[model samples]
Target chain A: NAGVIQTPRHKVTGKGQEATLWCEPISGHSAVFWYRQTIVQGLEFLTYFRNQAPIDDSGMPKERFSAQMPNQSHSTLKIQSTQPQDSAVYLCASTISAEQFFGPGTRLTVL
Target chain B: AQSVTQPDARVTVSEGASLQLRCKYSYSGTPYLFWYVQYQRQGLQLLLKYYSGDPVVQGVNGFEAEFSKSDSSFHLRKASVHWSDSAVYFCAASRTGGYKVVFGSGTRLLVSP
Candidate 1:
């Protein structure tokens, strides 16, 4: 099981540009989660999906951050008009039950 | 609100020596505790989890954690440390059947030869 797969291990975008991170979860896993990691904030929950539907997104920034799970296998996090503060490692995790298996994460850099 | 605290920002240990990392949690309900490790440049990986029954739970790679409800603590330990064990350890907690998993500020472990 490839665990979870995240695209573009690294990404660089100018301020006000758009950045979209991709994640492909393990097969048959019904739950997917997204988190942002930084030196100051540690791991911050962004959003989550259960069975291809968004369950909770209380941690999302609400203005520019959005997430979607179009199918059981994949999900995406899109940031519109990215700012410098958006730079961080975006991590994706998938779980069949409670134990979450994480992907290598995408490092997003907004300059 | 739920929260977790990892008091130590960094810990250094000699190779083959025993190791321990401290964690404290705050929650009113029955807690679901977990310990996860992050290798450099990698995402976090689960080490162990404690839900009920025995307070002492074993994990992969010779890691174990003991949960103390009285103290609200779940600390990770290893009998013998290896260089590969150098990484950041994170303590997390959640309400039973809840989707929100709160994480603590990680403790960075460094194993020296």
Candidate 2:
């Protein structure tokens, strides 16, 4: 298996621009997770999907962050009007059970 | 609210020396505990996990963790270290009823030759 696949290993966006991160999960895995990592905040859970349905997004910023998993194989995390504070490593993981396999994250940089 | 805490922000050890990374957790229920290592520019990889049964669990690459409910801690240990073992370690937990996994701030380990 390829584990999980995330697109654009690095992203650069100007302030007020938008950033969309992509993730392709492992085949047959029913769960997907998104996390953000920054030096100050450490690692924070952003959102998650189970069986192609959003289960919980309490960690997400209600105004600007959004996630969608329209199908089983892939999911997307979109940030509208990206701000400098949004710069961080966006990680994605997929799992069939308790053990989740992660992809090399996309490093988002907002200037 | 659930949280994981790794007290040490950074740890340095000589190669061949023993290693220990501390972790403490808070949760309303008996949660599933895990230790993950993140290599440079790579995603976090699971080293070990604790559910029930034995308090001490063995993991890949000779890594093991002992869970102490009394202390509310799950600490990762390695008998001997190598240069390749340098990475950031994260302590995490998940509730049984949900899939939201909470993570610690992580402890960076540096193995010096």
| TM-score of each predicted structure versus truth | 0.96, 0.96
Assess each model's interface with DockQ, reporting 2 decimals per model.
Answer: 0.68, 0.65
Total backbone clashes of candidate 1, pairs 3 or more residues apart or in separate chains:
0
lDDT of 1 by residue, B18-84 (tens): 9999999999876899999999999999999998999999999999999998899999999999999
| Residues A1-111 of candidate 1: C-alpha lDDT, one tens digit per residue | 778999989999999999999999999999999999999998999999999999999889989999999999799999999999999999999987777889999999999
C-alpha DockQ for predicted model 2: 0.65
Candidate 1 chain A TM-score vs. reference chain A: 0.99
Candidate 2 wrongly placed segments (more than 4 Å): none
B69-113: candidate 2 lDDT, tens digit per residue: 889999999999999999999999888655668889999999999
